[model samples]
Target: MKQVLVLGAHGQIAQIVTKNLLAEDVQQKLFLRSSARLTVANPQKEKLIEGNALSLFDLQQAMEGVDIVYANLAGNVVESAKNVIAAMKAKGVKRLIWISTLGIYDEVPGEYGKWNHEQLDGGYLETYAEAAQLIEDSDLDYTIIRPAWLDNQDEVSYELTRKGEAFKGTEVSRKSIADLVTKIIGEPSLYVRESLGVNKPNTDGNKPAWYR
Candidate 1:
């Protein structure tokens, strides 16, 4: 059984994915800035590591013995990507599942595309795109997951788009992204060195429903 290190363990999606992994054969090293806030479900199976993604030392510590890394992070993502790649190289961990946002490639189409820019333009979209570029340029087996506008709906419904293909639909449940993460963890060979755009099947709109 391979151990999986989950960065940004405090995030909503990370927490959901961590909980899902708990039931599987994988041992989890949950890494975050503050560890005390996270309650370990299985003491023997989950190890809460207190650390920040921006620190290479902390990331290396968490990467110790981790076979796969699932990073669900926010804030200064470009620096985070650099530190993550450095730490993984140092620790010789290959596989990475990174959470990113839509429109990074300007792949979103039509009215929804314009709306996406309206919401995520300026610093947010640009920095994420830079971070993603760093990952793609790395030698690691990385799967970059770009999910559509997220919601808390309790369903797993999503479709995927390759890097060059235009993005599809509008909104997708957080559960859907988590399910994809769970699936990739179960089988590391699922989407290696690929960028995937995840969205709901029929959610095409100018923007997410809550905003419209």
Candidate 2:
């Protein structure tokens, strides 16, 4: 049985992933800055640890006895990834599933390219790109998932692009992203050392439709 540690467990996508993990009978450990952020029902039943991801001591403590690390974190993501890498190395945890964004690699095409770059260039894209690079270059077994603009739609459907491939469509559901994360957890070998771009098929447009 794989023991999964979810960083940023209160994030929308991470919450969905946690529910799915519970259903699959996997051991779960949740790390968040505060217990108040956890809205998941019966959070106390899981191994919920309160700590900052940027702190190595906190991460070291939370990562104990963990098999896989699912990083669905935001804000200073680059620094967070570095800490995760170091902590995982110390803990001897080998698998990492990292959540990233499409625009970080300039993979979107046509007008959407302009829009994505303009929207994320100075802030999110730069930080995410740096984080992605760090993860890819690390010795740990890692899969970097780049999902398009996240939506709250309940359906779990999506498309994928391999590393260096042009991203497809836009506006994948948060459920879809969670499903992918769940799948990766179940099969650690799948997409290892790979970066995937996930989006909704047939939803291609200049920017996500929701932004219009």
Candidate 3:
């Protein structure tokens, strides 16, 4: 069984990913900033490790004996990604599955996309894009999955495309993103070093229904 370490185990996407990981038969290690903030009950508690994703010390501690690192960290994406890369390098962890957003590429051409760009002119998505660029230039084995407009729906169906291509959809379910993350963990060779945008298929106005 592969020993996997997950960062940002408390966020919405992280929570879904954590649930799926725990249900699997693999050995999973969760790294969180605080245990008090986690309200989810894990019957198998031994796999969970509490640690801050932003702290080098905590990251180093969590990186030990891990085969892959699944980073879903939030806030200051550029700085956080830098720290994560450093920690992974120090511990000789070779695989990273990074969670990013679709608007980072500015490919979604329309009023909504324009609004999104305006809103994130100086926000986390900009930082996320910078971090993604760093990952693109790094030597580490990485796959960046950028999902569009996440929703709380229950389904896990979606389509994926390469960078610079329009997503054509929006508001993918959190469950689908989690499924994608799990799929990456299981099959790292499929899209290594490639950044892909994921979304539901568009059925109207050449754009996906979710976007409308």
Q: Which candidate is the best by lDDT?
A: 1
Q: Give the TM-score (vs. native) of candidate 2.
A: 0.96
For model 2, which pairs clash?
none
Instruction: Write down the TM-score for model 1.
Output: 0.99
Worst 10 residues of 1 by lDDT: 203-212
Judged by whole-model lDDT over C-alpha atoms, candidate 3 comes out at: 0.79
lDDT by candidate, in order shown: 0.95, 0.90, 0.79
* lDDT tens digits, residue span 13-126, model 2: 999999988777588888899977775555544777899998999999998999899999999898999999999999999999999999777888899888889888877899
| Leading candidate by TM-score | 1
Per-residue lDDT of 191 in model 2? 95
Question: In model 3, which range of ten residues has the least summed lDDT?
Answer: 203-212
Error of 1 at 159 (Å): 0.9
RMSD to truth, every model: 0.7, 1.4, 2.4
Report the number of clashing residue pairs per model. Answer: 0, 0, 1
Residue-level lDDT of model 1, residues 1-212, one tens digit each, is 88999999989999999999988999999999988889998988899999989999999988989999999999999999999999999999999999999999999999999989999998999999999999999999999999999999999899999999999999999999999999999999999999999999998988888765
lDDT of 2: 0.90
lDDT by residue for model 3 (1-212), tens: 77888888778998887778766655677778777777646645336678876788888888899888888888777877888899989999989999988788887767667766766677777788899998888888999998877778889878988987775675578899899888887776878888888886652133335554
